[model samples]
Structure formats: structure tokens, C-alpha cells
Target: MVAAYPDDVDTLVAHEPPINAVLPDAAGAARARAGFYEAYQAKGTGAGMAAFIAMTSWQGEFTDEYFAQPAPDPAMFGMPTEDDGTRDDPLLSQRSWAVTDYLPDAARLLAAPTRVVVAVGEESAGTYTARTAVGMAGLLGREAVVFPSHHGGFLGGDFGYAGKPAEFATRLREVLAD
Candidate 1:
């Protein structure tokens, strides 16, 4: 949207938007990218999803034992462990490397009139998404704006991942208003 309507938009609130342009380590980046595919292919939906949960929940870069880490239980997160004998998962089915691997056009972003405020979850300070948000903001010559909750901070009662949605919305509104 920024590319097509640079002038039409005013402020962009980027909440943990994974812009990989500024990731520090290439090897670590590749490992993280392959994490989901390896997990799902090796352990089916239940365990793979568990692995995915583990991956995203990681506080920092994937450790040396990341791949060896036990698959997380979907039941723990109120997610369905049993695959319904179908392979149509929009989230896990495809390796959309393009999105996570994206390196946004920093020049265009800076030149555009839109004010991009990168938002990161307070609890997600050391996580990959938070790091990525910070990286993107740094590229834009700014620090990410802190929000009230975690990565899913704006989420409320969805998939057992509860965040301070009301507070999050208030903070977001404040950012937009500024």
C-alpha cells in the first residue's frame, strides 16, 4: 500500500511487522526461516505447530538448540493438534519466505509523506518480531515505539492468547493521534 498510495496514507502503525532488511545475522536468519518448514515436515501438524509456537515465543535469536527443542503442545495454546486430514493451512501450509524475508524499500519509506511508527510489544522486547521492528525503525532513523503488551498485545481472547487489547488500542490511538 505504501508503494501505491504513498501520498494517500497519513500514519502507518507497524505492529511487529517483520521487515528482515536489518536482521544482524545471516546464518541465524536462515535458520529461523527454515525452522517452521523443518518442524512441520518432520513432526506433522500438532508437533510442528508446537515447534512454531516455540520459535515465535523465543525471547531472542534461535539458540544453538532451537531445532532440538521439544515441540510445544498445541493444547497448551488452545490450538487444534489433530490435523483434520487436510493440508490447507493458510498460516503453516506455505513457506511464505517472501513476506518474512522482505527487505522494505528504505528510501521510499523515508521519502514518502507517511509517518511510519513502528510499534513493538513491551513483553516481546527481545523476541524476533520485536527485534525486526526495532531494526526497521532504526533504518528509518528512529526507535520503535513501545506498546502495552506482547507480540499479540492487541489481541483479545483469541486462541488462548490474551493481551491487554483495550490498553493496546488506547496506546495505538495515542500514537495515531500524534
Candidate 2:
């Protein structure tokens, strides 16, 4: 939006967008992503979620060691081990791969009037999205603005992953005000 309709916005707070193209080992990352998708297709939601967790929780670059790890067990994460034989999951499937594969147009965004503030959670340091946030900010000749919590910081307890929503909101207000 900032690149296309630059005049329609002022401050664009992009919070921890998981653009794998921004990573150093983008090909490795894509491979790792495909591994999880494969897990989903082979197993079920449980195995897929387990693999997804492993992928997301992995720190630093996607090294050979990352792939050498054993396949995650669904029961380990308290998930079902049964294969329901369904593959329409939005997150586990390749449906959202385009979003992660997106390579941001830095020059176009910089030329725009919008102030793009790439944000990452303080607790998400060293994570994939955090690194991408930093990389995205670097592409814009700036540093990533630290947010209050994790990736889903703004979310409430309804999602079972509660974060500092109040503090996150306050920080967001401060960032937008600036």
C-alpha cells in the first residue's frame, strides 16, 4: 500500500512481516518452509503445526544443522498425531507462500511520502521475522522499531497466546505519533 498509494497514508507500521526473501539464506528458508508444507500434506494438522513451530522457532539462518534435526512429533507439542488427510489449512499449506516470498521494493517505498516504520517485538529477537524486520528496515536505510511483545503482540487471550496488548498499544500510539 505504501508503494502503490503513497499519498493515501502517512505512517505505515509494518510489524514483523515474515518476508523470507529478506533473509540471507532465502533459498534455504524456502526449502525449510516446503518441508513444513510437506509435513502437513503427509501427516495432518498436528504434524504440520509441529513442523511450523520448529521452523518459526529456529534461530539464526537456516543452516544444514536446521534440516538435520529430527522431524517434530505432534504429541511433543500436545497436538494430535492422527492424520486427518486434509490439506486446506491456510497456514500450513502453500497458500500464503506468496506473502513470504515477496521482495519489498525499497526504492519505490523510499521514494514514497509514507514513513515506513518496520517493527519487531522485543521478545522476538533473533527470530526469522525479527531478522526480516531488521533487514527490511536496513533496506529503507533505517533500524527496526522495537515493539512491546512477540509476533502476535497485539492479540488478546482469546487466541490462547496472550501478549502485552496494552503496552503494545501504547507503543504503537507513540510510534504513530512520531
Position 117, candidate 2: lDDT: 94
Candidate 1 lDDT by residue in tens digits, 45-154: 77567766776777776667775666677688666677655554455555566777777888898889999898899989887889888888888899999999898888
* TM match of model 1 to true structure: 0.87
Per-residue error for 52 in candidate 2, Å, reads: 0.7
* Residue pairs in candidate 1 whose N, alpha carbon or C atoms collide under 3 angstroms: none
Report clash pairs, candidate 2. none
Write down the lDDT of every candidate, Cα atoms only. Answer: 0.77, 0.90
Tens digits of per-residue lDDT for model 2 on 1-178? 8888989998889999889878888898899899999999989899999999898879999999999999999898888999988888999988989889898998999999998999999999988888889888888899999999899999999886788999999999999898
Task: Give me the runs in candidate 2 sitting further than 4 Å from their true place.
Answer: none
What is model 1's C-alpha RMSD?
2.1
In model 2, the worst 10-residue window by lDDT is 155-164
